[model samples]
Target: MATEPIAEDLAGICVDSHGSAIGMPQLCADWIPNQVFWLVIALVVTFFVLSRIALPRIASVLAERHGTITNDIAAAEELKRQAADAEKAYEKALADARAEAQAISQKTRDEIKAQLDEAVEAADAQIAAKTAESEKAIADIRASALENVELVAKDTAGAIVAALGGSADAATISAAVGNRMKG
Candidate 1:
């Protein structure tokens, strides 16, 4: 059978020399030194782990990551500079091509203009020659018509004189007709 707690046992455990409440043994001063000793040991082990192992690894990783980011940014800037240079080169080449095309166009125009001027000069020469020939032909036709008119006038005069019973003189009629036709 279990023995019941006696009065002596309860009295001895409930009251102590100090006026402190009774609870867990952790509240007692006798455990203070042992708790302090364990606390110090835990702190030393934590410092060693952080400083020698975990913190150095994290720091190295951070440093490596920063270096990678910086290198990537630097590479991007270099690529941008190269792109700008390429654009400038393209613009320069385009300008040069345009200038070359303009020069070619100007040269073609000059050559065409020279040919046109030559053609015009040749046409003018031909027109002048034809005009001179036409003028000479007109002069010849006018001279022949003047001679035919004189001969017709003489014949008419001779016929009229003979019909009036007068002497028909060819030389006299010819002389009179020539004098009238002078203007």
Candidate 2:
């Protein structure tokens, strides 16, 4: 019986708190309706603020970034093009230099060949001239030896005749030569 009374009291308190407009205004009536209106207003204000202020700023920033990226890409392309041109120019110059060097080397080789040929010709002529002079000298020596032999023969014949008291004739000289040869 006591538990039944306490239960009734608790039930009464629960009904008063939940029911509309007796002590305090009903919990939902006091704030929930007003809160709903304020929530709608805040959402409308947030939409306007985002669309007019924040979203435009974000879009402009994105557009500026895109423009900057495009400009950077263009500049990079220009630099790449310039680099390619420079490389081509460098290759052309290197090719020209190699060609020029080959030409110079060929010219130098030709000049060296010509000089060698001239030097060979000059040396051959000098050798020929010296050979000719040596041959002439040998001929002169042979001729001189022959002349001396003839002169010595004449002198020896006269001496033999004088030594033999004028009796030595050609036959005697011949016999003497034969005897000398035998000895």
Instruction: Assess every candidate by TM-score.
Output: 0.72, 0.67
State the lDDT of candidate 1 residue by residue for 122-151, as single tens digits. 999999999999999999999898888788
lDDT of 1: 0.85
Q: In model 2, which runs have C-alpha deviations exceeding 4 angstroms?
A: 1-33, 167-183
* Model 2 weakest 10-residue run by lDDT: 13-22
Can you write out model 2's per-residue Cα lDDT over 91-141, one digit (the tens) per residue?
999999999999999999999999999999999999999999999999999
* Top-scoring candidate (lDDT): 1
How high is the CA lDDT of each candidate model? 0.85, 0.79
Candidate 1: how many backbone clashes?
0
Which predicted model would earn the best TM-score?
A: 1
